[model samples]
Target: MTPMNPDADAVERAVARLTAALDEGRPVAPVRDLIGEHDLAAAYAVQRELTRRRLAGGAVVTGRKIGLTSPAVQRQLGVDQPDFGVLFADMDVSAEAEVPSWRLLQPKAEAEIAFVLKEDLADGDLDAARVRSAVDYAVAALEIVDSRIADWDIRLTDTVADNASSGLYVLAERRLGLDEFEPRETTMRMYADDVPVSEGAGSACLGDPLNALAWLARTALEFGDPLRAGQVVLSGALGPMVPAPPGTRIRAEISSLGEVTATFSEKSGKPEKRDA
Candidate 1:
């Protein structure tokens, strides 16, 4: 196994190579194979290094995204629970951004009811109502997920080190009061290219967004990083993800809340298939 402190130069090379592959359509080394029998700390440091470089290149840190909040998703990844990654400004589409289809490679979109926090929720007992009290607003969000792993074949650790397949997020222009919304009772439909794909109730996301948020609170605290006030939480994917094809429009509608959409960049499209 790799030691706690992996070679800094090696980590840098891995990050740079991965970033270059993403830009130039080159094949990337599978993360699992790259870190075989290695300590997680070493692998994680590579992720941080990659994050730093992306930031230096104009990626703005906007919010954080949590993944695997659904127990079903956790079981699929063979993990106990969820993980997180910082959201870059580039990942957000402010209700006005134009999306053409083509820039993303094998993308998938899922709807989520997001919680915009008002006050700090650290060390608090977070039931549904308590989570509601901490919320300042709610918006319908679409999470555009893309896996860096080759063929989407991954273990829980590979996912963690890959930053939870972090992708684009679209926030609806229409925002509603948290108290006015029942995320648990909420239902949403996922559509791709004007075709109805799948639908789900809030229960799909770890038994409602609030319970998902509560899990995040406790997990963060365990990691020595508690969630702070004003951090927008994407409770998790509301519906089963629908394949997002380029030149196609993707959207979602949350009950009583609103809708969000994502249009990929036409000219900047990626390859249609992968070796996954």
Candidate 2:
């Protein structure tokens, strides 16, 4: 185990507060005032601690998700680069499953490409080509992001500490080999219900989703965690995220990839009794 940082107590407190908010299914005020200002390193430290706690609680780490890679998203968040969050097995909502809106604080949906790696990518000097070589295949994905910060008011540090505002993800079953589709050229059309909400090309994600993946590969290693084989990596958003409300069915079709769907509904107290 690595030595705990001097601000370990603060990190722990932040983790506790955020975890409680998540556990109780409620939003909390941003922790910036509580943890001090613009401490990116400390924010990441809090994230690491939070991940440790979640892992201890039987949450299996399945993959990672990159955020704020698109120019529009970056501009919206006022960030220059991308942020990432750890993905756990429990976070994987099946494409056919109906998500419970009440379980999430403030949910929104973004279309993305998910890369499944066949080999470990640990090099800090990784480039897009090297990144592509490690990818086994790519699938269409929908990232349902929820922020714990009240009213979605957050800064870079606030979000990093809040696990990149990750909530749930649904991945399409179809897999396309790297050669089968160009990540930069692929286009995505997102729909809320049957109406189009947003559309964008893969290039919108830092010129290419692979580029964002490369950035994540390098960044993860710097944080002492490396991207390993068999882990899915969400390569950021291809378009603007649409508000995901209860009873709304969302879908995204990626050119040459396939379509993925997510439906949000109110959670029921009990399973409906079905007729024989």
Top candidate on lDDT is 2
Model 1, residue 101: C-alpha shift (Å): 5.3
Q: lDDT tens digits, residues 52-156, model 2?
A: 877776778888999889776677767688989999887788744698676677899999999999999986458877888999999999999999888998987
lDDT of candidates 1 onward, in order? 0.70, 0.85
True-structure RMSD, every candidate: 4.8, 4.5
Candidate 1 yields a Cα-based lDDT of 0.70
How well does each candidate superpose onto the true structure, as a TM-score? 0.82, 0.92
Which TM-score value belongs to model 1? 0.82
Model 1 spans > 4 angstroms off: 1-17, 25-27, 36-43, 56-58, 100-103, 122-130, 269-276
In candidate 2, where is summed lDDT lowest over 10 consecutive residues? 267-276
Summarize candidate 1's per-residue lDDT along 1-276 as a digit string, tens digits.
122676666566656655655666544555655554334565566666666767777776655677887777777766666677667766676554565334354467788887878877677676666767888888999888776666666666556566667667888877888658778899999787778998989888878788888777665565555667877778888878877765668878889887887776654646442211
Estimate candidate 2's alpha-carbon lDDT, on a 0 to 1 scale.
Answer: 0.85
